[model samples]
Target: MGILLLMARERVPRVMRGEIPMASIAVERDAYPLKARLLSNNFDNQFQLPVLFYVGALLAILFQPGWPEVVLAWLFVATRYVHAYIHVTHNRVGKRFMAYAAGLAVLALFWLWLILRLLILAPSI
Candidate 1:
């Protein structure tokens, strides 16, 4: 959320500088042909895979997930940070995809562990 907020804040100055049109705020489409829309794109990207992260995190907190879960969560966060940096800077699709894939792998592992834990505890519940 902080990252998203920061991106939004940065957009204001860019808009004020006439890099982006005030009317462009109504939609996601970038009107500025010369300016890089890295922040806007990154902000949108946060809503995609990170939705799963939020769900997994809620479940983990509810179930008191183990150290592996915690570690995987941190790994996911780290990869996301890397992804954001790659996305907003060089905008290298290959490198950004790799970072995204790493985060997805971590998230998948975390989900697998969470599901297994739930299955194991289901009988007692």
Candidate 2:
């Protein structure tokens, strides 16, 4: 969504400057290929480890989350936001990696908490 917004906002200037054709992106995706590639890569990154985060979130709900789970969830979200910011902006690989790693760590912790809650706290069905 953010990438789409960025692409839409970016089109105005590029179209004026004739960098990208004033046509459908589907027809001229490569008119300004580099930015397109960057946004595309960032969009693809969404499905990677974030898939795990989504699963963990759902499990957290099913397993009955408390303060620790809630805090870890917020941390994970913050890391994703940081990762996206660095990914789309300056795009320094090192910084992007750090943010990604942080998100991964928080996700791991979230899963761990969920597992413990399910095994130790949840009443058997």
On lDDT, the leading prediction is: 1
- Would you estimate the TM-scores of all the predictions? 0.82, 0.77
What lDDT tens digits, residue by residue, belong to model 1 across residues 1-125?
A: 76567676766677789877778866665674422467667878999889999999999999887898899999999999999988877878999999999999999998998898788855774
Q: Pick the candidate with the highest TM-score.
A: 1
lDDT of 2: 0.80
Could you give candidate 2's per-residue lDDT for residues 13-119 as a string of tens digits? 77777776567455645666666557767878989988998888888787667899899999998998899888877899999999999999988888887887788
Per candidate, the number of residue pairs that clash is 0, 0
**List of clashing residue pairs for candidate 1:** none
Off by over 4 Å in 2: 11-31, 123-125
Give all candidates' CA lDDT scores.
Answer: 0.83, 0.80
Candidate 2, residue 3: the lDDT equals 74
Q: 13, model 2: CA deviation in Å?
A: 8.4
Pairs with backbone N, CA or C atoms under 3 Å apart (clashes), candidate 2: none
Model 1 TM-score, 2 decimals: 0.82
